[model samples]
Target: MSKPYFDPDFDNLLERINGPTCRVCIDNESMEDCTVVKVDSVNKQGLLLEVVQVLTELNLTISKSYISSDAGWFMDVFHVKDEHGNKLTDQKLINYIQQGIGTTRETPSSAKAKTYTNKVFRPERNGYTTIEMSGTDRPGLFSEISAALAYLHCNIVEAHAWSHNDRLACVAYITDQSADTPIDDPGRLADIEEHLTMVLRATTAPSTSGNQANQQEVKTAGFLQGSEDQGTMTNVERRLHQLMLSVRDFDGPSGPPNLPAVTPTGSEESDEEGRRTVVMIESCDEKGYSIVSIDCRDRPRLMFDTVCTLTDMQYVIFHASISSGGGYAFQEYFIRHLDGRALSTESEKERVIKCLEAAIERRVCEGVRVELCADNRAGLLSDITRVLRENGLTVVRADVATQGEKAVNALYVKDISGNEVDMEFVESMKREMGPIVLHVRNETNGRSSLPPRSSRFSLGDMLKSQIDRFNSLTAL
Candidate 1:
């Protein structure tokens, strides 16, 4: 965990700023057969998603919601109920919900910290490098893993992760971003392994030792402080920063607001009619990968959805540049098959384009919706869809996106028996899917109960077993 670049005073300012706070007050009167949960908190990125996750795990159906954010504060009111279409009376459950969404304040540290183990190992693989880790689960675990990968310059192509009973396992297929190949240098691979091991160990380790606890607290405080700073930035400033990072010539017509001469990178593609998105793939022999360029009208989670689809389909992204301007996003990804071959046939290219297009379109549709955010693991999409299918939920549309270690999935569905999604069905689905999402979220957030001995296994084999167990547990 390298300290984020920031002014010396920034940490002090963050310490003074209040983080998010949550309160769950059960509505006793007014709304019949419903409980209203009101949340007032300082706004941060992904706040809504986190709230939804907590409610879903509690088996509460949100029949209606009023959400608003102003300046830096957010107030959300959710009309919720149990499966029997009755108001909730469980004080225990209400307490659990409050605890789940409660904010933890960060205190800045006076001393610098060492963050890595610096040990690395090279696993034997031909085209891809496999990194697998298992440990006691904790909050912010996935974010730490993602940071480690980014620090090592490793590009994740595919991933499968799961957490069960306070234990977590993650497997990722990666390639060196600069070289577009499996990490071959023993020294570099050693460093990658060492750093990630340290991150996982630190998160999993108990804080009984006062010295270690202090160190961990300081590290987390710094990380949260950086998050606070980013959350305070205006949308325009954030977008402008993204634009500057993606475009080489800031003077072009496509530059940020008021820079009329800076030309936008995807303006030509935007000129076309009717198509909200354009996907182009071309072979790059020298690089041994295909170049994928996507120009589209930007919307929420566009990049995450695109990357999720690619990873799910087993395509490997070596290098990528993602930028948004005005109202559109321009993206370029250097990709290859898992077997290290370029996409060759027209059919293959069309399939790739169609998948990306469909994923983008799904994000804009509405139906009987369920939202999930968790640590991204390999075969996670399969497991989620399997649960829905088993519960007779017919999926009409689906959207999956990942930011850092968190995968957010939205599914639009209907009952297979041609009935509207009633309370019974919603409860059933929640009961089945709640633990899966909660476990991943908890593990990624660096919170866990205890590690199970059976949790240790290879990534592929472990995924299969875990899915099988879930099926057995949720089998109708």
Candidate 2:
């Protein structure tokens, strides 16, 4: 019989060629529209996600990808570009990508070098305290959080807040106003935690189901507590997803906005024009794999959201083909449980579909996009959110960041009654906050414009060749 595709000897041979460090090769001359990134490394359980995370965090758009890692070695190729659809020509960015996914050195056996975990190396230029909070989500909840932080004299430098199914997860980096450094006082830290916990409890209505108390958690940590030489950091967005999952955010009535119902037999469903999200699952009895297919509107970080969900759900992806074109995304995965079993029961299949649907929906912001840029201050968030609450708008999603002296923020807001936001209100707010500082970007009610029915691309035409190539490489 022919040797298996992932034979041990094949991996040994790769180790000798690539050395002990991960190999990242970039080809800019090959693809005109995108940069081709090739990675070869020893196979690890979570290595796929580690590589994807680096790209996603950089705000790069992955146009196409082929993933294969079943044994001792992993090799993959990705076609990527910036949001503007240009090739990556920045030398600094290219070098960072190399260092982010591979070691600083080609061979690590002899030289003493600073090793990178997950290719993360954060320098200690600024000191800040990291605050993580999760609890019941409510309208105007962010305003309250920011108000409290401002009251504590903390300068909010960066924050990300996500809400799904009446749950909220927030991570904020702040510095003490007095010292411009992380708060290291034990007593002060306890006070901050206690105050935030109380605010969370007060905002949440009494849960008739008696599960409300289980959703609250507050953590405060100093970024300077650890050794400065170690450059380890957590992917905050991934952590937010985990926190939302931990609170059972997927159990809500919202599965995606326009996705149709899916049955246990993996019946495929789409909108009348087939523009909405389409999900289907099929089990390969002979190969012992459960195949998942997803087709939906393409957006930034689309693959990261799905892959992270599958990984967190304890499913291992043996093979996957991902590609996007004409503002639509196509993804297929051959996966199995960590215990090496395919999805057997009907309930198991249904749950997988629902969880994947929920994962997709969590990142789909549904409202008017409002961007705020101003000088950073302790009360900037507090003031901005307060005005939003008072203007009959509710923030559905928010991203707050600080660059040098500027506080740049993006917020998605809808009318309190869930109607389309009045542009008059938006203009009024822009004037109130200074027209030069605030701007209206995009208004997406969880839907993008679909191509005309006659010109719609079919799944078979988009994915068949890629799938065939993957199968050919893995065939014994």
Candidate 3:
């Protein structure tokens, strides 16, 4: 028996390694793209084990590799292709790789360089973005649209909504929620628009299904509202909207727009850049109501930076915006890009607003009650962390408060041992900080489900079956 092999930085293990020579070809090409890479190690088995991933990804025939006729010089040669136009052969493979890598310019076929360049932006300094929604009204228009947006997760910065003549038009700065969600896919946006239309129709004017109550909920749904009470969407509009959203190619058939080819400052592309989007934002609103005020040059940059950060951190973009002011305090004008994908779920969407509103409260008035009071000496973040650590709890995320000499910290903590530090620990940390405050908790962290789980098979049965198979095979 051979000693097992091991790769320090990767998953390859030496003990179970097999040689590169395969007498039979194993090909399964239903889904994953076929790409393969072969390796040469201390032995043929070790090298073959290392190349498993390359084999799966490249989808190559392993039996046809360049294997040494003599056992002394062990080598596994894969037929992988490189930009240098050389096949992975026994002799020139290493030299071919040297030419393939460490170059200043990348090749067109380099999947590593494929990019999805998206951006999530708040309102910008001088640019403008506008969203005009015109449709028949229905009950739950506002709530459904707002709720759908709440579901899709978006924020309204500067909005002017009204029912004019007989139609509804809604416009606002959508970049308020975080630039992680983009309204780029015409299909998705259209679906959302259709849903918005349905939501609006349902809210503005119910289809005789609603008398008045659900209809009222529709009116305040979002900005898009028609005075009529309607719900549910007609087939034609829904189909058309869905068709429009089927856009996948980021760069259109005409190629990138003829703007000066300059990368935006502070924008980061992925290692594999698969797609990219550009947006311009502009708007105005009540300064005190949100941090969304246009103070100077950096203000727009901050908004831009926030969007960029969202896109870079997640895959989303702020497509466009346009705005002017209304609210209160320091008058403002701004527009923002609403990146839809940023908030992964409807609940997350609510949290997005929750955070934004908190930011807005602080912006409107510095000393406004943002959250619960903090404990000082015991309440300090470090002390609380110490308590959590001492109790085998790992702090997931934390928010702290400070006023004059006193402080308070709220922590979201969990333990690797599957046991959580209780309210006692939280109170203890609070006491260590300064004044002891009551601890409120959500006990949902890491507690295993007590409810019966549904699975295809039980572990005990699975183990027995495996043992039976092994016994039968050994006897054979």
Structural similarity to truth (TM-score) of each candidate = 0.27, 0.77, 0.19
Best by TM-score: 2
CA shift of 63, model 1, Å: 2.2
lDDT of 1 by residue, 48-83 (tens): 445554565455655555555545565667777775
Name the better of 2 and 3 by TM-score: 2
Candidate 2 lDDT score at position 71? 68
What's the candidate order when arranged by decreasing lDDT? 2, 1, 3
Q: What would the TM-score be for candidate 3 when compared with the true structure?
A: 0.19
Report the lDDT tens digits of candidate 2 across residue range 143-187. Answer: 888999989887787888887776677878877876778776767
* Whole-structure CA lDDT of model 3: 0.29
How much is the lDDT of residue 125 in candidate 3? 36
What is the descending TM-score order?
2, 1, 3
Candidates' C-alpha lDDT: 0.50, 0.69, 0.29
Candidate 1 Cα misplacement greater than 4 A, ranges: 1-22, 82-86, 104-476
